[model samples]
Target: MYAELFRLDGRVALVTGGSRGIGLACAEALGEAGARIAISARSRDEGEKAVRHLAGKGIEALYLPADISSESAAQAVVKQAAAELGGLDILVNNAGIARHGDSLDVKPETWDEVINTNLTGLFWCCRAAIETMVAAGRGSIVNIGSISGYISNLPQNQVAYNASKAGVHMLTKSLAGEFAKNNIRINAVAPGYIETAMTQGGLDDPEWSKIWLGMTPLGRTGKPSEVAAAVLYLASDAASYVTGSVLTIDGGYTIH
Candidate 1:
């Protein structure tokens, strides 16, 4: 029954930013569960490499070049992936951008860039994915949020990044509420100080690491696979009744 509960044998999934870091981990995890994957990224080389990696694992992986910031591009990506993979059953909004700067020092251009990629791009992709999912009357969407959306970092500032992620949290809930009747599930995964390219800047800094570890109950950073596991659960039938939930993959940071 457990096998039947989580199996994704015939599903087609699209994971934005699937080339590396947390996104790649998720793509691999889902692929291992038997889903056909369409990995999207701005870099063609990285996208192809990711597809090769998934294929090496005996997963059907397709490379889709897309920058999720453009609404038309986002829709086109969904259409193309659906056409190539036959249909879409899951969407992981994993593409994001972060910039650290003083709230006062953050320029409008920088703020727009962060919001565009982190929040607006996510909306675009969701809209496109939802159009398809709504027609099919079933779908699952998982947005990758950040702990910064709830807690602030002291040593370095990322005002725009935090704002956009916070928006993502709200967006997830709103989308979930609106689409629940349509048999669509929307959720957000907020990760805290995970070991990934996004956190390399903070990881290399002793002061930042000290602060993060001091706040987290676990005393250590989380692995990409750990987060991927959470994503896999949320995307599977095991979580069929879960929706509008903000699943935190933090190392007990919020508990403290």
Candidate 2:
């Protein structure tokens, strides 16, 4: 019974930025649960590699090369995924970029790039997915957010990233309220410091690693699979009654 609740048989899922990091992990988890997977990334090489990885696990998957920051690309990826996979049942807005610098010194282009990719692009993906889901009368969206949306991180200056994720948190709520009547659910997962390629530079720095571990009650950084598991629950029937919620997988970092 428990397993059945999490099974995604006959469902189709699209995961953006799925070539690596948390996105790839989410795709793998959803595929393992029996969902057909479509992964989109800016790099064709990375996308193909991700597809190969999923295939090695005996999961049916497709690679869609796309830059989600472009509205046309975002819409096209969703349309192609739906056409190829039969339909869209789940959407994971996991593509994001972060730039760290003093707000006073940050370039306009840097800020624009981060906000556009992290927030605006995600909205486009959600909007496009909603059209199909609403027609079908059922769908689920699990956005990958950051605990930075909740609390400012020490020693790192990422005002743009924090602000963008905060936008995502609210966007999830607003969309959920509007789409609930259509049998569509929108939610987000706010993960703390995870060991991913994006954070490898910081993690490799002894001082940064020590500071992060000290702040986290778990005493270590989180793994991509850990975050992926939370995403899986939200994407599956297990969360039928859940919506407009932000599940924090932060290893007790916000306790203070």
Candidate 3:
């Protein structure tokens, strides 16, 4: 009975930015749980590779190349995924970008890029997925947030990223309230510094790595699989009672 609680037998899940890192890990976890997977990414090479990887695991998966920063693309991706996967039972808005610099000196274009992709794009995906899920009367939407949303970082200045994630957290709660009656659950996962392609540069930097390790009580960076596990729990029936909540997977980084 406990094992059956986590099974995703007939579910279809769409994971944006699923080519690598945390997004890819989430896809793998969902697939392992028996869900048909649809992965979206901006790079065809990466997307195809992810598809192949999932196939090797005996999981049926599709790769959709899309830039979620554009509303049209976001909508199209969802449509394609639903069409190909049979239906959309779960949506993971995990696509995001970060721009670091002094808040006063950040460029307008950079700020817009960060906000558009991190917050606005996520909204578009959620909106499209929810529309379908509402009609079906059941669905789960998980947005990838950051620990930065709740606390400022010391070695990096990423005001836009932080603000965008905070927006996601609130958006998750608001949507949860609006969709609960429809049997759709909305939630966000706030992950701390994780080992991903996006954060490779920072992790390789002696100074930055030192600061991050010193600040995190775990004294080490997190892995994509760790975050993915939390996402799996939230996306599965195991978390049927969970919604409008932010699950922090930061190794106690935000405790201080």
Candidate 4:
């Protein structure tokens, strides 16, 4: 039953930044696969809205609200998910912020906020989830990185975002080695120019859109569901032997 490998009947997954965009898609995918889902993010309104949407599809979902930029807040959401969901078997770190500017013109606060949310905060959530997973003797973690981590994007100067996502890729490898003994797996997905709210602005801009689509071999953007499918595969037993790897979904943008 190869398909059974992707089933998560008794698993509990905690998805950060699960209110919208790729995060929500990941939550829906995991939930549809039979995993009980708990999603956390800064916006309570959006969180509740996401939960309702999941419910409409007969998916059991909980929205745990928190601003993940703070270590305490990030850790609290992880712990809360474990307590509420009975145990945490999977963790998806999708909460990240992007601040695009020239390195010299970037505000100190802007850089701090992006790094705090995208890297440091993701690590905080992972650390807490690992603690519980270690006790449970098994777990999985899937991080949402970006193709920008591998190559700089054209027409946008997002130094902070690029650095943070690059760190995420390395961190995934580092932790994968550190925790393999505990039977915990860690991996990342590096997406390029997906059609999410976070990236829609670029797609809407004629200049940005032309360069973006032109550079991609596929000649178009990606859907959130495409990213979600990858996340679901990594989070399930389907990727049991996969760890410390970055799966790139870039529509051939990085091939060159």
What ordering of candidates by TM-score runs from best to worst?
Answer: 4, 2, 3, 1
Residue 193 of candidate 3: its Cα lDDT? 90
How close is each model in CA RMSD to the real structure?
1.0, 0.7, 0.8, 0.5
Score candidate 2 by TM-score against the native. Answer: 0.99
Top candidate on lDDT is: 4
Estimate, for each residue in 153-189, the C-alpha lDDT of model 4 and write its tens digit: 8999999999999999999999999999999999999
Per-residue lDDT value at 160 in model 2: 96
- Candidate 4, residue 176: the lDDT equals 96
- The lDDT, on a scale of 0 to 1, for candidate 3 is 0.94
The residue-level lDDT of candidate 1 at 163 comes to: 91
What is each predicted model's overall lDDT from 0 to 1?
0.91, 0.94, 0.94, 0.95
State TM-scores per candidate.
Answer: 0.97, 0.99, 0.98, 0.99
Weakest 10 consecutive residues, lDDT, candidate 1? Answer: 146-155
lDDT (C-alpha) at residue 15 in model 4: 94
**Cα error of candidate 3 at position 5, Å:** 0.9
